[model samples]
Target: MIEILNPAKLAQARVTGALVADILQALKSRATVGTNLLDIDRWTQTMIADAGAESCYVDYAPSFGSGPFGHYVCTAVNDAVLHGLPYDYALADGDLLTLDLAVSQGGVAADSAISFVVGESPAPESLALIDATQRALRAGIAAAGPGARTGDLSYAIGSVLSEAGYPINTEFGGHGIGSTMHQDPHISNTGRPGRGYKLRPGLLLALEPWVMEDTDELVTDADGWTLRSATGCRTAHSEHTIAITEDGAEILTLPTQDR
Candidate 1:
C-alpha cells in the first residue's frame, strides 16, 4: 500500500512526526548505562499514551516478525540492528543502542529511528558506525524531492555507506509510510540511479540507512524479532519520515527544536 497524504492529513502527520521525534529524543536521554531494555519499552508506552498517540509497534504482527510485537519501541544493543524486541538486559557502558519508534495521531502515522552509545565510554568503531548511518541518511534525504526516483535516493545513501567501508543489507530498508507504519515502494540502501518509482508530491517515505560494520549478513536472535549482525559486529541505523512536496522533501520527523 502506497499512501499519499492529503494536505490535512499531512498536517496531522507533522504533529505525529514531531511527537515521535520528541519521544525518541527523550528516550535517548533516559537510556543510561544501566537502563534495562524493558524499562525503555515501558517508558515509550507511557510517552505514547501521554501524547494521545497509538503505538504502531505494540500490537504489530507482520509476517517478518514474531506476532504481536508486544513492545512500544525497538531497543537494539551492540550487534543488534533491526526489529530489536525489548528485553531484560541492562545496557552496559559503551553499548551501542538503537531506538526505533512509530506512532499515529489524528489518523496519521510517522516512523523514525536513532542510534547512539549507551554511556560515556563509546568505542571509536561504534561512533564511526553511527556516523556513517547518519551521513547516509542525510544523503538519502537530500536526494529526495518531487520528480526524483527512489533509486536516486538509494544510490545517494549507498554511496556514503560504501565509501565508509560498511556492508549494506537490502532485506530491510525504507518504505512509504502514512496512515500506517510501513507501506510500499521499498527503498533499498543501495540501488542503481534512474530506476524504481518516481517521486511525486504528497508521497511520504521513511528513508532509513543502516549498515553493519563488517558483513551484510544478519542473524535473528532467540527472541525471534531482534535482527543482529551475522558476525556480531556493531551496527547502526538512522531514519526519518519525509513528505515530498512542490519544493522538495520536507523531513517530518525532525525534533521540534531542530525544525
Candidate 2:
C-alpha cells in the first residue's frame, strides 16, 4: 500500500529515520577486518533496544525471502549483495561490506543501507563498484520530489550505473516504505522516464540502487536469504529513506549531522 504520512506521523518518521541512520553509521564505524557478522547483528540488537525501537527485519517474512529473517541487520560482504543474512563469517581486509537496516519507532518505519571497504586492502574494482552505487543513489534521490514520477528516479539512477558500465538488476530495487518496511510503488533501477507512479507530498520511498561487478544475474546462498553475485564478483548497494514534500524530496535517513 502507498501510505501518506500526516504531519504528526512525519514527525515520528523523522525520529525513526534518524535512528536508522545513526545505527547504520555506528555499525559501519564498528565494523572492520576480522569482525564477525554475528557481532554486528548483536550490536544492532543492543542499539535497537537502547533506542526502544523495533526491528522490521527480525520477524519479517516476505514472499521473496525464505522465511522470517531472524536477524536485526543485513551484513553483506564481497560477492553478497542484498538480503544478506548475518552468519558466522569474519570480514577480511579488502572485503566490501554492505549493511542494510530498517527499524520502526512510534509506528513509523525507515530503511537504509551503506557499502564500504573493510580495511586498507581496497580493491580498485570494488571501490569503483561502491562508488557507482552511491552515485546512482544520489541521482535517484535528486530525481525524487513532488510532481515527479517513479520512472524519473529509475531513469536517473539507471543512467549513472549503466554509464559506469555496470549491469542493472531490477529483481530487487526500491519500494515505498512507511508504517511497514515494504509497500507499494515498486521502484526499479532502470525504466523509461516519465512513466510509473507519480510522486506526491507525504509519500516516503526507500530508493536503493544496487549492482553486481560483472553480471546482472544473482544466485541465492545456502543460507536462503543472502543474494550473491552470479559470477561471484564483488557487489555494492546504496539506499536511503526519503519523504516527498511540498517543496521537494527530503532525505529522512541521513545522519543527524548530515540532515
Candidate 3:
C-alpha cells in the first residue's frame, strides 16, 4: 500500500526516523571485534523498548524471508547483505557490518540502514564498497522531490554505483514506507529517467543502494534469511527514509546532534 502522510503523521515519522537512526548508530558503536551478533539484536530491542516504540521486524513474516524475523535488527557482515538474520558468530576485525532497522512510534514508521567496517584494519576493498553505496544513496536522495519520477532517483543512484564498478541487484531495492515498514511504489536501484511513479508531497520512500564487489547474484544462507554475495566477496548497503516535499526531499533518518 502507498501512504501519503498528513502533516501530523509526517511529524511522527520524523520522530520515528530519528529514533531508528540513533539506535543504529548506537549499535555500530557497540559492535567491535569479538562482539556477538546476537548482542546487537539485544541492544536494538532495549533501545526500542526504552523509546516506547515497536519493532517492525520482530513479527515480520515477509514471503522472501523465513516467517517472523524474530529479531530486533539485521546484522549483515562481510559477504552478507540484505535480510541478514542475527546469528551466534562474533565479529572479527576488518569485517564489514551492515545494520538495517525500522521502528514505529506514534503510529508512524521509518526505516534506514548503514554499512561500516568493524574494528581496525578495514580492507581497502571493503572501504571502497561502503563508499560506493553511500555515494549512491546520496545521489538517489538528491534526485527525489515533488513531481520527480522514481526512475530519476534510480538512474541517479545507478550511475554512481556503475561508475564505481559495482553491479546492482534489482531483486531487492527501496520502496514506499509509512504506517507500515514496507509499501508500494518499488524503487529500483537502476532505471531510465522520466519513467515510473511520480513523486508527490508527503510521500515517504526508503532509498537503499547496495552492491556486491564482483557479482549481482545472491545466495541465501542456510538460515533462510541472510542473503550473501554469490562469490563470497564483500558488500555494502546504505539507506535513508526521505519525505518528498514542496522544497525538496527531507532526510528524516539523519542523526540528530543532541542524540
Q: Which residue runs does candidate 2 get wrong by more than 4 Å?
A: none
Tens digits of per-residue lDDT, candidate 2, 87-177, equal: 9999999889999999999999999999999988998998899899999999999999999999999999999999999998889999999
TM-scores of the models, in the order given: 0.99, 0.99, 0.99
| Global lDDT of model 3 | 0.94
Candidate 1 off by > 4 Å: none
TM-score of 2: 0.99
Model 2: weakest 10-residue lDDT segment is 60-69
Q: Provide the lowest-lDDT 10-residue window in model 1.
A: 62-71
Tens digits of per-residue lDDT, candidate 1, 142-256, equal 9999899999999999999999998899999999998888899999999999999999999999999999999999999888899999998999999999999998999999999
Worst 10 residues of 3 by lDDT: 250-259
Clash count for each candidate, listed in order shown: 0, 0, 0
Cα-based RMSD of candidate 1: 0.7
